[model samples]
Target: MGERVLVAHQPAYWPWCGYFSRLLDVDELVLLDHVQFSERGWQHRNTVADRYGRPVRLTVPVRRDFGQRLTEVRIAEPDFRERHWRTLSETYRRAPHFNRFADRLQELYAQSWTHLVDLNEAVTRLILDALDLKVTLVRTSGAPPSGTKTAALVDLCRRHQADVLRVGTGAGAYLDAGLLERAGIRIEVAAYAPTPYGRARSRPAGLSVLDLLMHEGPRARAVLMAGARTAPFTSTPREVHA
Candidate 1:
């Protein structure tokens, strides 16, 4: 049997290229939806390039509670769907491959999503499908309880039978290496250098996957996997036809 690698992260709204880059190398991905929702975090917003090629943030307005799990957070504004779609249309209509994905994009936005986690997961899945990534996705909300912090992470790995726990470099600050090692899980910190794509004059470093797709089209997945520390699961590229 091949090495079982598990990667887990909060399901970010319209996640950036680096998010997909991390997924490229993993066998399974667990969306940590049981975690507390943060208002200022990427759980409800992400950056994109505007019509003028400047980075702009597109956010989903959510009703907040003092201690709400991400899966429990509700959308504060019902019109967020129309507003976000309009923003994307106005900003990216001129992008090379925008029309290619526009129909499906519009369909996604048209769905009535009441919870923040549902919306984020829907979009994440859409982007993953577009990238042709085949990793199995799991949600922590449905998984067995795994204590808290690093302990929870290690437990998650154990539950999934992961020999290696892959995490982004940022996790180095918070995740205890000794704890994971003691739990019999090897730690691999992903070193991802973003691969530049598209013909935009002003390229932003970490815009959402939408930006990459609209610009690079069929080549977006290749660009995303270019500089990763580990090789992606599949080398056969899927063609994105308009």
Candidate 2:
């Protein structure tokens, strides 16, 4: 059988190009939604460039709970959708290809989404479609419960029958390669040198994938897939549970 590669990450709000680069490399991408929600994490927000080329964060307000799982977190204000759409429109309307994707993107914002996971998933899927990435997507909440941290990740690999696990560089800090190796899953850590997009004089490093799509249009996928390197795993421990 061919290698069954899996990439898993938290559902991020309008994630950056690196996220898509990682997704595009794998056979299946898993959304780890059953994990705890971190207010300070990328779960509900992402940065983008404004008209002046300054980085601005577009955040989705959510009802804060002491230990809420991402899947359980509800949107604090649905009205933020209109404001976000307006911001995106105003910020990127002059982008060379903004007109191509604006209407479809605006339609996404028009939907009523009460949960953060639902919103993030919808946005992620839309961007994937735009980029023409065909990887299968699965959610952890729908799968059998994986234990925490490395054990959970290993469980996910086992459940999906993955022969290889692709992860972002940030995950190298916490992911235990030995655990995955024991499970017969080889680890490929992605080294993504940020791909520059947009016509801004000084491009921001980690803006949302939308920045690339709006600015580069049909060529966005090529731009995103460029400059990605993968290496065999090594690691230290850190706080990224997923």
Candidate 3:
């Protein structure tokens, strides 16, 4: 088996390129769902294209109750699923290879999910399954208690006996990666670069990962794997299609 790696992150919305981009660098992907749900988090918000060339935010209503845990907090948007699907479809319909993967994208958004963990897992599965990756997907909530947020991830890594911990560039800001390194696990941070992929709709460059995935199709996986060839890491906050 390949080296085991742990990826712990907050719940993110659909179309997020950075999260999907990180999956290419790890053997196991663990979503940190046990953390508190930030109000303005990427969990319920993401960008989609309008007439403008940049990506704009679309928000979904999640319950304010944090005690119920992420997997239990209901996403209260009545027509949010349909709305997101139509909006993405309309915007990406003109993409270079949009038609080829449109039906699959539609099917992905159409599925119903009850928990936040399931939602994230389902979306991740859709993207990777399309690319035919065999990485194991696990949830933080499902694992044995790991103490605090950062330590929980570390404990998770220890439990899984991972050889490495794959983290986002931003993780160094708060996570004590040295602890894992001290435990004999290699720590690698992944940086994501948004490449320009043109669609027939004429949106700006690098809207969201979904824009890249839908237009690129089978090549999307290769594109993600090749992320290392770009800049060392991507921290620029820019929007393409909105």
Best by TM-score: 2
Residue 3 CA error for candidate 1 (Å)?
Answer: 1.5
Better of 2 and 3 by lDDT: 2
Q: Kindly give the number of clashing pairs for every candidate.
A: 0, 1, 8
After the best TM-score superposition of candidate 3, give how far the Cα of residue 31 lies from its true spot, in angstroms: 2.0
Full-model lDDT for every candidate: 0.82, 0.83, 0.65
Alpha-carbon shift of residue 1 in model 1 (angstroms): 2.7
- In terms of lDDT, model 3 sits at 0.65
Q: Per-residue lDDT tens digits of candidate 1, residues 68-163?
A: 899899999989999999999999999999989999899999999899888888898889888888877788887645589889988888788988
Q: Give RMSD (Å) of candidate 2 vs. truth.
A: 3.4
- The list of candidate 2 runs beyond 4 A from truth reads 236-242
TM-score for each candidate, following the candidate numbering? 0.91, 0.93, 0.81
Residue 73 lDDT in candidate 3: 68
Against the true structure, candidate 2 reaches a TM-score of 0.93
* Residue 136 displacement (Å), model 2: 2.1
In candidate 1, the residue pairs with backbone N, CA or C atoms under 3 Å apart (3 or more residues apart, or in different chains) clash, namely none
